[model samples]
Target: MGRILMKGNEAIGEAAIRAGCLNYFAYPITPQSEVAEYLSRRMPEVGGVFLQGESEVAVGYMIFGAAGCGARVFTTSSSPGISLMSEALSYISGAECPAVFVNIMRGGPGLGGILPSQADYFQATKGGGHGDYRLLVMAPAGVQEAVEMVMKAFPLAEKYRNPVMILGDGLIGQMMEPVEFPDELKSEPSNNDDWATSGMETRKSSRRNLVKSLFLDSEQLEAHNRVLKAKYDRMRREEVRYEPYNLEADYKALIVSYGTMSRVCRTAVDILKVEGFEVGMVRPQTLFPFPEKAIEEAVRRESCKVAVSIEMSMGQMVEDVERSVRGRCPVEWFGKSGGDVPTPEEVIDAVKSFVKELI
Candidate 1:
């Protein structure tokens, strides 16, 4: 609601409030603990629910409880904790409950180190849990984007009646920067009663509502999947957000990236520019939709020789980049995992090496 210097984690919690999410349920976990800590103090002041559950399992269930009660609820956790919550997250999507989850990603296969990693990109975008489900996974490149991405998450969640995740790295969670928000408080009408577990007779002559993800029959499951498919299709058509940077002149190359990795690409682009290289970047803001069109256009630029995907993981986003580029340009990947992130300088070196090969 005002201009302030805030860590990315704190900004996410604040943006939830700005977006009219009044309930937060989470456990303390590395890299993202500040999110819960911020809301724990701020929620009481605003008369909202802030709960620190015993474990990630309980935290996710707590979110389910709040969502079932027809409240706009949210939660935050790191890689392993998010893994623990995947069961409930799948259930939440199956119930078509509008909710938000933030994953300040960390490296992992099991018990990964506590530093920033985009290793969960696939998990967030491809549905970490079982069965066919998808979430709106937004990757914010910087603190401002993190704040706004979170604010957008609530409305998108309600619009689609599905879970949305703000997927950032621990660098994002710990890093600080300036953020601004609207002053006027405009609240939206709640659509919770149509499916929420509120008491009966409150709406007078309406039947009770049941919120659940259970369906035993194959035909029923088919019908459910069809509904989900249509929703995902609509999102693909309407919400594929991306940003193209330093493009007007033909470019030497296009860098494909997202989140903090995208910011690193930007820095690489700047260094390349100083050296008279014509490189640009196409950064996806909404990871789920994958921003296929902009990436395609970037790959087609006449000066573009290749598109390099730099990620903090073993190239999850690289898969999407290649799909978008569609053989128009050579695509290379440079990445690290297990809690490692490449700095802008390292990214520049990688890009230069890539360019040298093409030359």
Candidate 2:
């Protein structure tokens, strides 16, 4: 297929279809309503199901229900909508059903604005719903990456039998870019006879599969949680992904960021190099199972004096950055959480200031 110039939201819908995800449930929300709008038309043509639920909460459960039936399912929403769906997310995780979620972030705490913000960092990487559970979160820097992540998310979710999240800011959802849906990413849904509640009649088996999260017995619940923890640990070891820029240079300061902010930081790193101030950046593609080892290595570089977490949120990701750096060097944060993206010049100044303090 030829490269198609597409809005990020539209591309996500198409990508989901291409990934063999036939069931989609969503509630319209800003910066990403286009995804629902696009799929409403496209899904029918593909002989897939498209449903607009009454609310985000309803949409979430719809995804859960479909996934429990061993179907490829997903949903998309912004921050507030995601919060409404968090409870269902917890249930899906507990039941160990494979599902995909895409959050096109908007400024938050309360209907903050329709503009982009990465404030949901803590919500995504940390637990959003009740109980201890984790979502395999991927943050994409551009439309192309977002499309790729959406395609890849389904298989990962199935592999782990857990939900996967694609985290993007409003800019990523609204921007138009050239992208081709790679054939390598296309695949048929895996057989679910082993665990799916799809029905014994369909699989022609006597073994009845029960899918539920309820465990009234304390010991059984603890054992279930331990099993979940093991999967997460395996993910931490196997799924960490990141991109390092200018790490080859003997940089004085290392900047860590992701998603749209990483794109800005990349520009800042380049400009600082031209100005004879060597700076490096590590952009994490996966938020959970974070690129901890990568950042630890970058900050430990001999010439690196400090690690700065540059984000669109106030300082959510900085906490992870500090944990990753583990006191190897000074760790700091600089960002605007009020729907304003920090520009390359602002990032350059922040890096320069950090470097000056080191000198």
Candidate 3:
């Protein structure tokens, strides 16, 4: 198919449909409402189901129920709305249901603002709700990447029998870009009969499938947690993804960023390069199984005297960067929050400041 100029939110909605997601339930929230709106019109034409629930909390369980029944399902929301759905997310994780969630993040600690922010880094990569569970979190840098991530989320969720999330900022959801829908991602319903709650007749044996997170017996629950931990460990080993920019040779410093913020940092890196300062970047594509090893190696270069985290929020992702660098070099952070995006010039200045400090 030919490339078309598409808004990121609409592209994500279309990608979900193309990915064989037949059921969607979401409540409208700023910066991400377009996904719900776009799906509402398109879902019926595709012979799929679309619903705007009364609340984000309601929509989350709706996805859980549908996913449990072997239906491919997804939803999209902003930061506050994601907060409302966290309880259901925890339950869905515990039940090991395959569902996709898209969070087009806006500013927040409360009803903070309706603009792009990466403040949810800790909420997403760390534990948002409860328990020792992790969501396969993909943070895409641009509209095209967002579409690809949304398309891939369904299969990854089903493969692991766990929830997956597309973590994008408001800029990504609001921006327009040329995108092509790949024929390779076309639809076919997932074969989930083996583990799905598809009732007695669908089962090969007479055993009934039950999907629930609650296990009153402590021993059984502990064993289940061990199995879950093993799955997470496997994901860490096999699913870590990242993109390196200008890392082919030594650089004076390393800039670590993800999602939309990385795009800005990339521009800053270019600006620095022209000024005769070599700065490479580590842009994490997957946030949960964070590209720790990649970041570690990038900072390990002898020329990399400092590593800086450039984010849209006040140092949330910096924590992860610090964990990865592990004091190999000095770690620093530069950010803007509450709906404000840091410009390339601003990031360049921050990098210069770090360099000056080292000198």
* lDDT score for candidate 2 against the true structure: 0.94
CA deviation > 4 Å runs, candidate 1: 184-186
Number of the top-ranking candidate, with lDDT as the measure: 2
In candidate 3, what are the lDDT values of residues 234-255, reduced to their tens digit? Answer: 8999899999999975798899
Ordered list by lDDT, greatest first? 2, 3, 1
lDDT, candidate 2, at 20: 86
Q: Write the per-residue lDDT of candidate 2 for residues 1-359, one digit (tens) a residue.
A: 79889999999999999988889999999989999999999999999999999999999999889999999999999999999999999999999999999999999889999999999999999989988899999999998899889999999999999999999999999999999998899877888999999999999999999889999999999999999999999999999989889999999999999999999999988888898899989999999989999999998889999999999998999999999999999999999988889999999988888878879
TM-score, each model? 0.95, 0.99, 0.98
What is residue 6's positional error in candidate 1, in angstroms?
Answer: 1.5
Task: Point to the candidate with the largest TM-score.
Answer: 2
